[model samples]
Target chain A: MLPGMTTRGYHHGDLRRALLDAAVQAIEESGPAALSLRDLARRAGVSHAAPAHHFGDKAGLLTALAVEGYDRLADELGGAGDDLLEVGVAYVRFAVDHRAHFEVMFQPDLYRGDDAEVRAARDRAHAVLRGGLAALPAAAPDRDALAAWSIVHGFATLWLAGALPPEAGRDPEQTARAVIRRLFE
Target chain B: MLPGMTTRGYHHGDLRRALLDAAVQAIEESGPAALSLRDLARRAGVSHAAPAHHFGDKAGLLTALAVEGYDRLADELGGAGDDLLEVGVAYVRFAVDHRAHFEVMFQPDLYRGDDAEVRAARDRAHAVLRGGLAALPAAAPDRDALAAWSIVHGFATLWLAGALPPEAGRDPEQTARAVIRRLFE
Candidate 1:
């Protein structure tokens, strides 16, 4: 062990969170293909078996990350006041800021979607969007919700992939607001 | 060899197209992960190595598939007549009808983005949309084009992921039309 490294212990109280943070870093650096529990453990400076004890397997770690992602997304969008368009902007902002989490969360085949925590978190994030849409006029709440979700999610996903044009120089939040405004115009 | 199967036959003139068709079927059935060149060859009733003669590797095969997808999308959208909303509706129709192609085309990491054929195909598809947008008044063409592309592409992507609720029961084409109509309203 390196000097000042505390490796003479196995009772890592925050091992689960540490492993998840390491996984996010790994995904950001190398994409999802390079994720491995052993590699994550090594990066976390814990024994190779430590991550297994906390997460059970690679999928479990990803599920935890995704669950956390949903909660974070919900919190961010929920704080955007009662303006539906602002909530849409917040949704895009969350995706841009947390690209790793957003990417893994949507790829259903990468993690067990039925994981209780993951499902609950996803529902919470979804409910935040639903609530925002509910505040819209009652003529077509469902349509507006789907449209708003699609525009923000699409913009964020495309921007992160570097698929947008250079001329699209506006910040993500601005672009999102502009697009969402057009939805109700 | 199995009965009626000739190993040394020189009749693979259409093997390239056949392989692409089989790949589309495979992708639709199992998504991008389960696609295999050997399996595609088997489905095409050709020798295992025959696909290699047309596509250098699996990525090459996918590149060709993406190219075809872009061409088909351009054709569908271009044929939507003068109604921009109808064009958006056709975009969603393409996604629903050609789920396999839509899935592979968007995954930038999976295909050779720099390939000349792929670039040309993508540009052609983009031109179709650009041309459609050019027909609108000159005042706000740039923002209008971006919004139009984002809405249609985003809606199709979300719908295919089954992210929308069934109670939103509005068909994708109908929903796309409504969203696009709002852009001009």
Candidate 2:
């Protein structure tokens, strides 16, 4: 092992995590469209080939981000309490706090859809949201789940896009709770 | 005018419309972030500089698209009949049919948010939705409007993102009506 610039001395496991972290910052700075593995590699202070080796290409890196995003979303939604209203608010909170992941996760065209990891991660997140719908009173479970997801997802998407009016406010969790409360009523 | 290859003979108004049409098709084929004026010019059979002259940059073109989108949304929402349910259904239809426009309109970072045309157009669409909410029984006009917008907007966004489960089915307008009907119930 040589000095700071030694290529062979760096751990592969650490490099992958560093690249993923750099991706989040890059996405936050510029929307996911401008994400480049080369930039991530440069930001991580690794050789250019390191990122390409770990993620293949732009879509591959985004798929990784999306997989991480879905898993995180599942963890948050499943742990946000069993109350439907609370779950709905938690959905919004996750989106706001994880804007980079949320944005990339939804734009399927931006990532590799065939990756098994992505599919499984997405399933986990869906299960969490769908499970929360069991508490709702609609005669049709599917339609009710769609309704519950849409209200929260739509609010989150609109909020992130800055499409909502000023009165909607910046407190995603609080505002989401108020709007979602109407559904239960 | 000398045949089809001359950029000098291309009318400014005609080129502008052609570029806008190209953008819609391009956005539909690839998500909005991948849109390039140069690619649009090649698609439109105009000089490379023609698009830049009209829209200035990538953001300028998207701003135009956003403006057109909002104005069109206002028209559809206002004319979807006096019933809020019908209006909500129409909103879903617009989103599905005009997916390209709808996608760009909401993502303000993709365009010039402060552009006068965008602001005015957005206000027109907002007024139509806000006016529709007045018929509801809520003491809080703004919150109710936000709720209505969130449900319909969320449903549309999910449908477009393919985020809703297969049980929600392939017909967006139908699923949207069923889900949105929850609010009216």
Estimate, for each residue in A102-175, the C-alpha lDDT of model 1 and write its tens digit: 88887666688888888888888889998888776756666667777777877887777766776677588887
Off by over 4 Å in 1: A1-13, A29-51, B1-10, B33-48, B135-138
Which portions of model 2 miss their true places by more than 4 Å? A2-10, B2-10
lDDT digits (tens) for residues B1-185 of candidate 2? 65543455666677688889999999998878888888998999888988898899999999999999999999999998667788898899999999999999988888998999989989998888887777778777777788889999999988888776678888888888899888877
Which candidate tops lDDT?
Answer: 2
In model 1, residue pairs whose N, Cα or C atoms come closer than 3 Å (at least 3 residues apart or on different chains), thus clashing, are none
> For model 2, which pairs clash?
A154-B154
Task: Compose the digit string of candidate 2's lDDT tens values, residues A75-130.
Answer: 99999867888889888999999999999998888998668999999998888888
Expressed between 0 and 1, the share of native interface contacts present in candidate 1 is 0.35
Native-referenced Cα lDDT, model 2: 0.86
* Candidate 1 CAPRI category: acceptable
The lDDT values for all models are: 0.79, 0.86
State chain A's TM-score for model 2: 0.93
lDDT by residue (B4-74, candidate 1, tens digit) is 33474434545677788899998877677568889998998888988887898988988888888888988
